[model samples]
Target: MKYIVTALICFIILVLISSCRNDFGFTSSTGSLKFSQDTIYLDTVFSTIGSSTRTFKVYNRSNDDIVIPRVALAQGTNSKYRISVDGVPGQVFENVELLAKDSMFVFVETTVDIMDFTGDTEFLYEDTIEFDSGANLQKVALVTLIKDAVFLFPERDAEGIEETILLGTEEDGVRISGFFLDDNELIFTNEKPYVIYGFAGVPPNKTLAINPGARIHFHSQSGIIVARDGTLKVNGALSTTEELENEVIFEGDRLEPLYDDVAGQWAAIWLTAGSINHEINYATIKNASVGIIMDSFNNASNGATLKINNSKVFNSSNTALLGTTASIEATNSIFHNSGQSAVVARLGGDYNFNNCTISNYWNGSFRQDPTLLISNAIPNTEFTADLTAANFTNCIIYGDRNLELALLDDGTSTFNFKFENSLLRFNDSSNSFDGIPAYDFSNINLYNQCILNVDPLFEEVAAFKLRIDNTGGANGIGDPASVTATDISGTTRSTSTVSGEGPDAGSFESSDLSGS
Candidate 1:
């Protein structure tokens, strides 16, 4: 009897150990808690004068169905804090379970007392709500903080009026919402900087120029359209390391792709003719329609001179830089992983680059014009550039053809196209011009000085990105010679040396050109 009792005790201990081992950070299909965002950033905090609201996303990264028990304010006050459980009332616990890979959100409302609270928090505030088992609880904090200076517009009231905010009320340090005015003119002086959505809508008769370090957000369909006399000048800055590589969620995309990820849902700063000059410097425009577009429908042919320097356009749709009849001078910039062509020009447009790097792998079709098998597609149907009129010199152009570039049957030609002392390459079968041969280029010019094999050595093309390594001048070209950003595109660019004789062949120079 004693031996049997001892055996029974041993068996029980073994069972208990097994159960404990199963409950690791890993959850079973039968447990609770779900989360999509591994982390969330309030970015900053608001003051006591008013408040701000940001979404705290929840996702069920697990395959099980979990429930939320109770949602409460954990050490946070009512004025500065409030969270809704899936937009529900009364803290109902039954409905918060997130399905596998499904999405739900928690709304965090913050009110800042402008006259009262004045402080900042470098770290995000954190708390927890009671969650039932099986609920894959993944939560990120949503915070709103006060700033040193905020753009407050004119408040509406019956009695008095000192000033009106240029960007209206709803956009007070929050999201972007506005009308798509195509025929209106907008002017922003020193004191009155127009609060804008994205840089996609350069409406008719409107010209917009942003001051240095002027903050703008492209949250929704915020972009620009340059109507007659409409122009846009954006002067942005080099995002800090913590802020430079960002992650965002698109409508039809996954949770948040990396900074270089391209969903190709690009919007553009579309420029029409007779617009004012656009000068953009030291900025970052990511995940827009198109990085910058010069519409080709204008008859005046004077699309506008776009000066770009020390900029970066990442993960956009086809054609990072699209121009028509516009003189573009871009230097010390970078363009990579475009869904289509990195740069596209039409209607006698000019593309001049120096010490820039550009790369793409979108068959160069979407890079320019990707459509059905229409006989009159832009590149294949009719392509012409007035070389004496069009200028693409002292730069690098690369695509997925390896070092050998692929040419569309109806693509632009090198007519009076002066490529002096530049390197050009493609990734075709021959690795030369013959490997990718299906075009009519009777009008062209070339000055391939020290250009290695006349091909663009793209280390990673399938990924729609490029790394120009001007090591041996064999595969990729780095900026070695001094390149000027203001030369071709007339952009006020930063000075930096490129690696290859082909030099940095795209829109960006990776040499820390800011010298900071």
Candidate 2:
């Protein structure tokens, strides 16, 4: 009796297992597959470089388990495009199964060679992903803009050792990877965009010149270094219109929209000690660890290290303009949106800013430092030097912080600084530095007719359009003698008939305030 009962139980278990076989009977799909998008447009990509992945959904809306007999690219593996069905990647797939009333994700990416393209500079590359075969075939178009760029990267040796230039030896002797630019590649033109993969060093005594409308894109950790005695010139001309037609642009190699305003995508442009005659005009430098770094061996001389005019430097993870014992002359420039200080003069320096705007609206995190920090001494160090002259004339030094300007001195060097007819944001709600000698607003030599603790009423802070309006406190109260004839945008500076005041204080001259 026990043996008979066990046999019946085994029979019941076998029946249950046979009923659970659900993988075998998939019907061949008809031409009823639906897609999230009929076409997927991938953003611009450099030649021979892979693009960011884009996705679309493939839905099997029918009430039956379907099997796609063939899912492949229309070009049959000769195509530049690649696709991944569901989670599997391939140029061609077979027997792709989808459950009834379910969906599958298809991710597409591409890398196209310039030689294969018909256009010289840029071309639209297109392909199609075909689902199934012949009569039941459905297609989704893929498109991407391929741009030809002058790619600059370090070469490797026969043994796979990459060539590297010496940036500087660390205290323990570590070094960063970099390489010197070839002599023929010193001149960057507007014919095509430049994509740099490593630190492109300018050799001593060599000049690196960039023409107007030139675009420079640096990979992660990549930058430009001007060695001793080397000169760096960016001759970008001012555009007649507000679109900045001939402006030079410096940013990261990632052309995707997601990284448009992201900071710290690349390293800073370093003007090393003894580098001279570096001039930048009508240029835009953004998305760097630091916008530019001017360094001097010591406070041995107060000669000009950089002359920047009608330029914009912003969206830096660190300080935008970092100077160490270096002299800089900046006019009609805008520097803002930095993780730390927008402008930093450390270990003493000679800096003259005229009709410039230095503001920080760092929304990434809680920023600890001010927008501008000028010191006669190095922090937590014994290094101290003379601050020859740190002057801001007819400028705007402001930010989201309570105090946007900081002055530090060790009492061992000359701390000479001045702000004439400028606007400064020093609300100091906490009264943190009320008794500090640096915040002595009554000192006419340090603060002459400067507007303090007032909002500038920027047109759009998020977009970095810092042009003030009629309601702006910095509208027309500038020192005419110190102001530039024309602002950064090529707007004429004039006395305001409404306020009966001089030109606007910042880099931009408000047309509405000037009644122009």
Candidate 3:
């Protein structure tokens, strides 16, 4: 009886194994394989750098289990691109089994050496992934524009560590450090994009001049700094007809579409103490923690630290223009879309903004600060500096907040400011600033010829286009003498006006040549 029972158990186990084998039998169905995408187009990438991995799905949609007899690249073993099937890394795969109604992932990556190809500066790389003896073939078009860039990086030590220099001495006894640039590497041209890996500082007594049509790309936490006694001049001119015109661009290094409007990708363009004679013209600065930070420096000999004209500073995580006891003169410029204030003149030395537009419609996060903040003291710190003069003429300050302007005075030093013929969007509906001395509209000396709580009727706020629409009441409202002859787009500011013939109260003049 014991021998008979043992034989029955062995027979039962054999039957179960046979059933599992039959359930997973391979099918010769070849054309039933489905793919996620017919063709995958990888965007432009620089030379000698590995691109981000792109993924696609391979699905077995038939009722039976399928066995891919062969899966390989069309280039055989000489392909520059690399592929991974499922989780295994290889150029070719075989006997890849997939159950019915299941799928697997195939990841593709590549690093192209531009010397291997023959082209001006960009080359096209293509490859195919063949499956099951050519029964079904899928191709991924790998095209990249390999640009030759002037790479600026810090020197690495023997252990591959980057060297750094002191940024400044903070009030809390903390020291900030960053990478420094030599005097020989001061001039940047427009031949190729300048890619900086860290904070590229202009050393003392050195001057960094950027030519027109230059594109400066910065990595995360990277920026450009002008050290004490250093000068920075960006000679970007306005062009209306040329294809590659002279307009300098500063932004993050990510070239993907998802990262186009993302803010705070890099740090600020810091003009440190004692830095002098910095100018930016017809430039576009975007996607940074702070657009331009002018540190406190009492340079009576240099006049102002920076003079910016016909430029746009937008999409900053912090204030677009931050002046801490620093002098700045901006004309025909636009400062918009900041997470905090668009312009923060704290402990200011001297600031003059004419024919400019300061607006903030930040929707990235919940912003607690106003669009414009002016103060003569640092909050929570016992540090105070004199605000000698701050003047805004023929400008517009508007945003999507209840109260878009804030003025804080410690009542210790001189806080002198004047707003003339400007449109301001400040709401006192809740009486928030009701009894505040700084916000008293009755003071004609501080607020002169200003229009309050009026809509500018912008063309498009989401696209950062602040051109005044037809419904805007700002036309012919500005002082003709205070407004510039030509707006930022080189159009006459009074072209649309007929009766009064006065300029508009913003950086842009409404005309046919308004769209960028």
233-291: candidate 1 lDDT, tens digit per residue: 76555544544322111121111233235445435666656565777777666666677
**lDDT (Cα, 0-100) at 411 in candidate 2:** 88
Q: Please, what's the RMSD in Å of model 1?
A: 11.8
514 in model 3: Cα distance from truth in Å?
13
- What lDDT, from 0 to 1, does candidate 3 have? 0.82
lDDT of 1: 0.47
Error of 1 at 278 (Å): 2.0
lDDT at residue 361 of model 3 (Cα atoms): 96
lDDT of 2 by residue, 24-83 (tens): 668998989999999999999999989999999999999999999988988977999988
Q: Write the per-residue lDDT of candidate 3 for residues 222-257, one digit (tens) a residue.
A: 899888889899889887864437889999887666
Q: Evaluated with TM-score, which candidate comes out highest?
A: 2
How accurate locally is residue 13 in candidate 3, as Cα lDDT from 0 to 100?
Answer: 100
By TM-score, the better pick of 2 and 3 is 2
Which is the leading candidate under lDDT? 2
RMSD of each: 11.8, 3.3, 3.8
What ranking of all candidate models by TM-score puts the best one first?
2, 3, 1
Residue ranges of candidate 2 with Cα displaced over 4 Å: 1-25, 168-174, 241-243, 297-303, 496-500, 511-516
